[model samples]
Target: MINDKVLAIILGGGQGSRLHPLTEERSKPAVPIAGKYRLVDIPISNCINSNIKRMFVLTQFNSASLNRHIKDTYHFSFFSSAFVDVLAAEQTPENKGWFQGTADAVRQSMHHLLRHEFEYVLILSGDQLYQMDYDLMIKAHIKNKAKISIATIPVNAKDATSFGILKADDKNLVTSFVEKPDTSLLPEWNSDVSNEMKAQGRNYLASMGIYIFNKDLLIDLMSNPDTIDFGKEIIPQSIHEHKTLSYQYEGYWTDIGNIDSFFEANIGLTADIPEFDLYNKSKRIYTRARMLPTTKVSGTTLNKTVIAEGCIISAAKIEQSVIGIRSRIGDESTIINTYMMGSDYYQTLDDVNNSKINIIGIGARCFIKNAILDKNCCIGNDVRINGGNHLEDTETKTYAIKDGIVVIKKGAVIPNGFVL
Candidate 1:
């Protein structure tokens, strides 16, 4: 019954400039991750696992792929009220411009939200990687009789400066808030965290950008157009005026805000025991159930690699990589610390043999390290891309170098013996 009274809004971030080439063609939420799943799948799967089925994803930029993914992936009984919808910004008689910030996006879409029956609104970031049961947060909110609740994670001082830090009382009631506070002010902003967290030097509570607001409070807050962002405006302004509870979550959570974090999150899956467990049956990460065949590999030395379905890998060695679906790697190639987002569709034998173009996937005798191969890439033979601190950041038509990681653009064709 509690689940029925809750509605979820997942905010797909703005242009996602930090994620540059990856967001060049698709929305942030639609960006593929862990080889097969989209970034949006994280929040949607979390909501579903928490029994909160009604959700609306708010996205504006390049949402076509995100729209298609949601439509194809999530399906429920025709008679059931459960559904996931994508709400892109639209020009209206009242507001014409794009979403100014987080609050603005939800404000513009409130008309559609009012039609649904809900008591509380659960707001989530679409670009985050984490697994959590939101039902517990909602329960805490009800028990504490709070008007708003924020999911806070204990972060060390070094990591706290980049987040909206919160100071909570012994009762877990947020007392003060600061957005990306200076390092010098960290001592005054410390919150009482678990002994385990304290031992690890994670003393401050950082807002996870996850919130639960009473339906009435959210509707009231959205009326003020001046307060555009929750973290920047709504939260700091309302903390003193309202009873806001802090729901502490100590889990494997990462905000995939840029290409670097995104790359690390995907590659981290190859760990012997990954912090973000994909093997958990109870908290399964749901995605489109494509009838894909098992990945086929031959004589490849795989070490700490996670390969998705429908891959044909004949690489000499693949170490610490996440190989996606429908991938076709040629022989004698070596891949290390890479995330290869495999092709959308498999290349037919006729096309591979007859076409005077490079094949879709890695070519023979290539050495790719510390890179990301986007979907449907045509890597030529004998290409050697060794990414490291030695190379400066640069971008070309076919690929980009960010923080020493070579990212091959989607559908790009690298010439034979190309070296980076």
Candidate 2:
């Protein structure tokens, strides 16, 4: 908590169009990550671990799933004053539009949040996957007596151009800020990699979009109606006047904005030495605790996989993948490099006699390679889903498939031995 007040506003209103089919029916934050968790869970879990109880999720586009998930999972009724709530965009007399950007989302919710008595208000993006001890950041904020603190992380010269790069002085005061700078017009800062670095300086801090705002300053800035976003306007505009501090973070943090990044983050878990360890005992990542039984891997030979609770794996081979709770795999099925969601639905697969065809959901025998299977999909036995032999192409029509992997939407059924 900055300045003795503790209230956090999570900006989760984005449509997440980049995620395409996954975000077709749900908000970006509600989209499933690593099969067992949603994107929004990361930030909320971080807040709970930080000991910050009061959180408000501000969303607008496709919030049904997100709202429902929040209701079913986060229910802390013990604390009357501190709670977690979802605030949607409502038409007011003064404002007649949806949230235009990050700052706009907070400005829209100012009616309720600004009236409350809080010292510091934290604004975080719900789409990133990382483990942070916000209490440490808050303590540093109080010690420095800073008006605002932006969490920054160092990136290579090539990556710095794609992000909102920040420049801080020796005293940790922000000196320069630019969003997605051109590589050709960057200056070399490090001597060793000056020639190798085509972009700006070799060492630069990129904004994580995580902020700790003094409540008064946040309210005053939002009231002005001139500032648009913290990175694009507010922070840079007030860098000289306000004591804006840059908090450096050297940990695992992925924005997971596009499909490539999302897929890469999930597959990273299977690494022998993963950068982000979910099993860290000191900093527990909290999520909706499921009461399902432990996953049972039968005679299947599995390697580099994260299987959640209540999963019953029969005779099958799973490699470099993540399986959600209560999901059952039939006999002689091969699941290769794919993520499957969990469900309690059970069906008989003893008669299943297919190895080359990879299956997704219960009793489905599917033989898939480098494909993303949606939840609750039923694949038939002997159904070869080889969209392509090449790994680069995402679409495959050899077996009448549109994409490299056959995307069976939620609750879809594939007949027995049906290809594509």
Candidate 3:
């Protein structure tokens, strides 16, 4: 009954310019992650694992792929009232503009949300990597008789400066909030955190951008159109006016805000014990059920690599990398510290044989390191790409170099002997 009384609104961030090339063709939530799953899958999966089934994902730009992914992947029982829906920005007589900020997105879509009967509204970010049981937060909100609840994570002083920090009382009631406070202001902003977090030097409570609001309060707040963002406006102003609970969550959580963070999150999956555990049976990440074949590899020395389904890898060596679905790596090639997002569909035999310059995947004798090969890329033979700080930030039609990581654009064709 509690699950039925809760509805989720997932905010697919605006523009996503920080993740340029990746967001070039798709929305931030649609961007692929961990070789196989999309960025949206994280939040959606967390919601499902938490028994919060009804959700509406709000995205504006390049949402076709995101829409398709949700349509194809999430299907509950026909009789069940569980469903995942994508709600793109639409123009009406009252509001004709796009989502200006996080709160605005929810405000614009409030009409659609009101159709469903829910007591609490769980607002989540689409670009975060974490596994959380929101039921616990909801229960806490109910127990505290709070009108709003925010998920807070104890972060060190360095990371605290980059987040919306909150100071909570002994009762875990948010006392004050500051958006990205200066480092000098950190000592005064410390909250009561667990001893483990304090031992790790994570004293300040940082807002995780996860919120829970009573439906009535959210409806009342949406009436005020001036407050467009929760962090900058609604939160700081409302904490004094309303009872806001601070639910502390000490777990592996990362915001995929930029290309560097995105790349690091994917590559981190190859670690011996990844912080974001993808193997937890109780907290499984859901995605489309592609009946892909088992990955076939030969003559490749794989070390700390995670390969998805339908891959044909003959690389001489692959270390600390993630090979996605439908990937083909030619023989004698070496791949290191890379995330190759495998192709969407396999190239037919005739198409492969008829191709003159390059194929859908990597060619023979090539070496790629510290790079990301997007979907359906054609990397020709003898191509060498070594991404590091030595390389300057540049963007070509085919690829881009940001923070020293080479990102091959989607469906890019890199000819033979190409070097970066």
Please give the range of 10 consecutive residues that has the lowest summed lDDT in model 2. Answer: 394-403
lDDT of 2 by residue, 1-420 (tens): 342378988888578876766676788888777767888888888888888888999899889888888888887767456677888888999889888888988998998896678899989998888999888888878788999998987777777777887777776767777777778744632112223332534476788999998888887889877676777888778777888888877788888787667767887888888887887876666666677777787788989987878787873688988777667777677877767766534444642345554344645355755555566666565555553445343432211222344344555556677654
lDDT of 1 by residue, 22-53 (tens): 99999999999999999999999999999999
Per-model C-alpha lDDT, please?
A: 0.95, 0.74, 0.94
TM-score: the better of candidates 2 and 3: 3
Instruction: Estimate the Cα RMSD of every predicted model relative to the unseen true structure.
Output: 0.7, 4.6, 0.8
- Best lDDT goes to which candidate? 1
Compared with the true structure, model 3 gives a TM-score of 0.99
lDDT score, candidate 2: 0.74
TM-score of 1: 0.99
lDDT of 3 by residue, 1-420 (tens): 688899999999999999999999999999999889999999999999999999999999999999999999999999999999999999989889999999999999999998888999999999999999999999999999999999999999989989999998889999999999998998899778778998999999999999999999999999999999999999999999999999999999999999899999999999999999999998999999999999999999999999999999899999999999999999999999999999999877887788563589999999999999999999999999999999999999999999999999999999999998
Assess the local accuracy of residue 282 in candidate 3 as a C-alpha lDDT between 0 and 100: 83
Q: Say which prediction, candidate 1 or candidate 2, comes out ahead on TM-score.
A: 1
Candidate 3 contains a number of clashing pairs equal to 0
